[model samples]
Target: MGSSARVTEPQPLPWRTTRVVLWGIGLWAVALVVTLAVPALHTGDRSWWPWCCVAGIVLGLLGYSYVRRGRGNASDA
Candidate 1:
């Protein structure tokens, strides 16, 4: 490595994996309930709420894994 090469150290993350997982689970559950509970949401040719719910759940899970991996790396250092 040259002198100009810079190394960046790990910084603290603001959120936790558990929080993210919980949010994902909650969002998914709520969306599932809404989709299943109300007949209107399930009806029609197109729907957005269900997709949004899926997005939330996926993103939350992704966030959780990302944070967990980051934390592991930080701890190793």
Candidate 2:
């Protein structure tokens, strides 16, 4: 009898995850630049700072999730 071996097939990842990651990075970068330039905006309210920070955090979290997913798949493969 021939030797029995298991063969595993590679699965393709969803494109939505990749798109989210790319968009997340883009948004994060934009937020960073805006935060840095906020002072130059000359707004005395100072409320934009908090909003910008929050946006950055949200984008970062999204990016992290995608990265973690990719890493998990890589490790599994």
TM-score of each model, in listed order: 0.52, 0.38
Q: Per the 3 Å backbone cut-off, how many clashing residue pairs does candidate 1 have?
A: 0
- Residue 32 error for model 2, in Å? 2.2
Candidate 1 RMSD to the real structure? 6.0
Residue pairs in candidate 1 whose N, alpha carbon or C atoms collide under 3 angstroms: none
Relative to the true structure, candidate 2 reaches a TM of 0.38
Compared with the true structure, the alpha-carbon lDDT of candidate 2 equals 0.67
* lDDT for position 42 in model 1: 69
Lowest summed lDDT across 10 adjacent residues in model 2 is found at: 41-50
Off by over 4 Å in 1: 1-17, 71-77
Error of 2 at 64 (Å): 2.5
Clashing pairs in 2: none
All models: lDDT?
0.73, 0.67
**Candidate 1, residues 1-77: lDDT per residue as tens digits?**
45797779877778765775777779797987888688788668646767777788787777677776676345667
